[model samples]
Target: MSENKGNAFDFKLFKRLMSFTRPYRGIFIFVAFAAIVMSGLAVLRPFLLKLAIDDSIVPKDSEGFMTYVILMLVVLILEVVFQFAFIFYTNWLGQSVIRDMRQKLFRLMTSFKMQYFDKSAVGRLTTRAVNDVETISSIFSEGLFMIISDLLKMLVIAGFMLTQSWRLSLIVFIVLPFIMYATRVFQKAMKVAFEDVRNQVANLNSFVQERITGMKIVQIFTREKTEYERFQEINKKHRKAWIRTVWYNSIFFPIAEMAGAIATGLVVWYGGLNVIGGGAVTLGIITAFIQYAEMLFRPLRQIADKFNTLQMGMVAANRVFGILDTRSHIEDNGTINYTNTKGEIEFVDVHFGYLEGEEVIKGISFKANPGDTVAIVGATGAGKSTIINLLNRFYEINSGTIKIDNIDIKEYTLASLTSQIAVVLQDVFLFADTIYNNITLNNPNITEDDVIAAAKEIGVHKFIESLPGGYNYNVKERGSMLSSGQRQLISFLRAYVSKPSILVLDEATSSVDTYSEELIQTATDKITKDRTSIVIAHRLATIKKADKIIVMDAGKIVEEGTHHELLENEKGFYRNLYEVQFADGGNP
Candidate 1:
């Protein structure tokens, strides 16, 4: 991830980010205007102070003094009003930008192929979409506005100071180079410190999310103490990173303060000498010069602070753009037509590897008619599941062609290919919503009748009906409210609701008890009757009725026949697996 050094702040990526704000250009323009007005108002404060000192206090004109006092009071009120407006507009623009960013990110994430999720961590992606975008929003709202205001204030103050007296202005301006040099050093140190802090913070967030999700496993294994120690190490690293940032800031601020102080002292000393030497300088002009000197350095100090914040924001931006920049190994060619698709599937000498040079499926071929039942049985990691993934194009084959209805799989659009197939995975995940919503997944077109019919077909309707709220009953995260078998049943129902042209059942009944397994087996048989079905089975009994069974061993097919035919051979891998299982008891 750290290799993103070159493209972190790429101009192209920044331009792409800016395009998201195009829709809200009006709000952004309003924010800019408010910032400029607020900066102009800030400049009036120092001028008012000079007026009070030189005109009111140094003179004996009481009548005119009250008018200046009234004018100063009015300017202060306007300053406060404009400051409020500035905050409102920037906040509005920031939130709008964040909303747009989140929507775009989520759309991109979901549009990506499954291979992206396989290679990326869920916690890291979630943090990027949620936390990183929020950080960018804060920078846009407060950090950006502060920068604009500081720059404008500095320019306005410089112009006024030069008008008052170029000699004194020159003395004050000498500190500009020192401030710039000091800020440059601080900026580099702060950037490194903030980058470390950001990395540590992400690590801590990932650790917490993983632990929370796996809390049951931790308690079950009695490894709470071990997990706590691991968490402590990560937390300590984050603390150290933050401490380093604070230490740099502590040193930087005082150096800046002392430099500003020295510049002020020089201005006062030089202006006094000119006055005593009979140079044309009055009390009012000297007072204004001192006021302008303070104004000048104040914005410079803000710029220093803003530089620190900008560095932090850049770190976040780099992480975000890193995600956006990753090109998924599997992507649509944009030429595939998805308007029509047939259900036929064929694998021709397909070879695949999850890692380089280690094939999981090697030169195996098979075909299934539009409505055929094909069963693949193998030991763990023998490539049964990989075949189904290939059929769905979740992974691209290293060699050979996968075709549907005699058309290459790559020629079909991803959406068209996926829409034709439904998979009930071994591990089920249900969102935190009502049973009806979980099944429909918020698809407005899916009616309640459709959900109930799918649930009934999967033999889970009775269990749902027993609940007080029935279809409206809410499931907790990951369906924790239900037992494992119940979750599987609901997942089966959800898959069935889609009514796909093809179905892949991958150990779909492995988690259930004997009674639920019998019920699910019956439901599975009924649902697969006339569909193009593929089953990856570990339990021999579950796939005994398959029309054709292919047994794989070490990434190649070792046997292919009916269940009885393979048992009769007694020399193939399928026969060996059956003997081992039935030898323990009657059947699994």
Candidate 2:
């Protein structure tokens, strides 16, 4: 949300934005050509009026009058048709360009490593993708194309005025410099105001989205009154930012109109004096010049306003490209697509830090042989979850090697690597979708039959069938409609249905009641029968039967053995954690 100061628009960024139009160059070229034609047509009507006055009315020729009138009417009709086409096509172009840009940006964001999302604000990123892109749409729709058309109209009208009477044109010319000066002042002021407006709008969107998303927490804490007051303050700033723009409009537009009026009065007075003095000035020339003055000034004023639209579009382009240029995404450099994974995972001298110079996983090395279940038990911040994230390639380790079947994980294509592994996260996120869709994640390859079979295998099929719509029951946003235990069961089924070579369950049964935990235990035993499984849990009871238990403290493993063997060692971290948990009848 950093604002670029001054009236200096980024021409390079503007050019880059225009590059999107390359796909529709033919349409863009036609639109440009239409502007020129429409401008010519706009000027034609005033000329036709001049002809009707001079050659027909003043000369008292009825046939000449009718001929000029009919010609003028034809020009007006043509102008209207082109104007409609121009507006329609320009808007179509704008919507189309933003559509591609939003899709590209979203796809890019999906590929970024976890570090990017961890550091960036979700609400702000959402604004950039949704609100900012919509603003960029206005550039082509109402800003750039409209400005071009207005400029052309002004230039053509100015030419007509000069040709009709340079003396009358001189009156318009004299008033222009003052108006232009005021316009420049007004435009610079508005540029700053518009930038503030956009910032405030982003702030508003971000605030609303975050607040609503976390409304449960707000209501639980009884912070509704306080949050509402804060919202009013943000809303006030938004209103003030807009009112500043309105204030500028209120001041600058009247100045332009007053100048136009002065030019009009001067033209009429000077032309009357010429007629009284019996000079060459005609009523026809004076009439055309007056119309010419309005055409010239109004378009100029509009150009200033529309130019602001172009500038705002450039601002949006700058922010969008900034994200597109980010190097936070992991490079999928591996040539190998390793699909037939043996689920033999090895971490050798692995080290990682979410933030630079502050290690979270410190040189931890471990192995889970094919079909062996390994449980990771650690205090909070002891890197159990970090290990799971690294194994899934969500974040690259600062230093070390991770391998599956003795092949470096980095040597496998990210897609093939992730496809071979399924993770049921500590926080089970479900989309506001049917249970079937949630399990398959809308993946076309995972059919209803496939999901049902997987659910039955995991022993959750009956529980789901007991729900209102069975497989079709909607979970609502984040599974708010389902209990936490129910959501965890769905997560387990989702992972099982993927038919992965390896499974990692991070605190899977932490939220489950006794009944749900028993279901999970059954599901776990069945699911991990042949495939390698890694479980990170605070509840020691869940991992009692794990083939190997790795106890960690302060990001380093302190003990490694089976749950029974680790408990036998009196000084072992696993033994201490076990005593601490069951003694309190709560998680360690």
Q: What is the TM-score of each candidate against the true structure?
A: 0.93, 0.97
lDDT of candidate 2 at residue 199, scale 0 to 100? 85
- Candidate 2's displacement at residue 224, Å, is 1.5
> In model 1, what are the clashing residue pairs, if there are any?
none
Candidate 1: deviation at residue 7, Å? 12
Which candidate number has the best TM-score? 2
Q: Which predicted model would earn the best lDDT?
A: 2
User: Model 2 over residues 315-389: C-alpha lDDT tens digits?
Assistant: 787788888888886778987887756889999999999989999999999999999999999999898999988
Taking the tens digit of each residue's C-alpha lDDT, what string does model 1 give over 1-588? Answer: 344432323345455556767888888787788777776777677777667767777787787778878887898899888888778877787788878877867877776767789777777888888888887776666677778888888888888777767888889888889887887787777767887888887888888998999999999999999999999999999999999989988988888888888888987788788888978666667777777777777777777787667666667766877776676646676356643344677888999998889999999988878777889999998999899888888888899998878888888778777877889888888998888888888878789998887777767889899986999988888888887777777777877887788889998988788877876787787778788889888889888888889999889988888889998986778889999888978855
Give the Cα error of residue 572 in candidate 1, in Å: 1.7
lDDT of 1: 0.80
